[model samples]
Target: MPEKQRLTPTVYVSVDIEADGPIPGPYSMVSLGAVTAGWHDADGFRRADGKQGFYRELRPISEQWDPQALAVSGLDRTALLRDGTDPAAAMRAFTDWVERLRTGPDGRRYRPVMVGYPAPYDWLFLSWYLVRFTGGSPFGHSGCLDVKTLYAARAGVPLASVGKRSMARGLLPDLPHTHHALDDAREQAVLFANVWEWDGVSRSG
Candidate 1:
């Protein structure tokens, strides 16, 4: 019998986006950030050392914006209008970054999977922007892994009940929730790895 080839390892890319409103088109994704959380194979999940990342502040395509949403990121729209990368250029760079991740820094070929906390909100914006600007997404039309849903299933809890506050402390690193896209993505990468490795059994008495 011939030997079988091993499946490509799964690489998790944690992503976070800061937007100017509720949705794309009428609004804008002011900033996009991402990092290679880790990879899983026959040896199991291993964290990325000196993780690779991508971040860009985008020029707004529409004038519409929500004050509360903009306030959360604390990013100035005026400054972005003046200096941010063009949306199309930014998306192209993002696509290139994702392609690079297919060959990890460790020299192993990997299958990159887009990961988001709850997923829907971030995914919606990312997908729309990628298609609108770059014409396609590196992760495909519907490819994504939701961290919140992953934990919910692992912990045997309701989807609506999962939140960082309810998660085990050790599962989350002592990183600040800066609301900055890159900072948040880095923190999320660690969280994704920790949760992925957790047994999900409650250790409480």
Candidate 2:
């Protein structure tokens, strides 16, 4: 990559997870997904390639898997059994992949931020899961950016006003179906891009 093509400091890991309900510890994480992006992708705000990192899926802990949550995510125990990787292994792989992006090929540290639509909800489950599985988050629990809060703040409105339906109607080309973790994460990313474009976000430093 050329000097101008070098990656920026602002990297985003947009995440989503399906659960039994609002509560964190008691409820369980059913399915989790995340897409990585960078500040250059901020709605054509500047010159940047907006390169994509990668997506990850982790195996759920047997005790943490909930039947009701499976109903919501439509993912059966059989599927998880066959496809999921162990939680600790998954976290190690995920953090390793993340570190690669945050650092240069030669190994410089990068502190890419994490982003989520309804942040605290997803982060609560993820943080707990990471701590339980790995003892701590590699990102150090810093920079948990909330898209809903960003939308609310930019629109000068409350969260209720920026409801998914309203946001889909006003900004997105289509509404995202909830419960599907990967799809939801992608939809939130799209929504964020659209909002950034509309709001004319200039600098994301």
Among the numbered candidates, top lDDT falls to 1
Residue-pair clashes, model 2: 0
Error (Å) of candidate 1 at residue 105 is 3.8
Model 2 misplaced stretches (Cα beyond 4 Å): 1-8, 20-25, 40-58, 62-66, 103-110, 168-170, 173-178, 200-205
**Candidate 2: worst 10 consecutive residues by lDDT?**
41-50
lDDT tens digits, residue span 74-124, model 1: 999999999999999999999998888888656888887889887899999
Best by TM-score: 1
Task: List TM-scores for all candidates, in order.
Answer: 0.93, 0.73
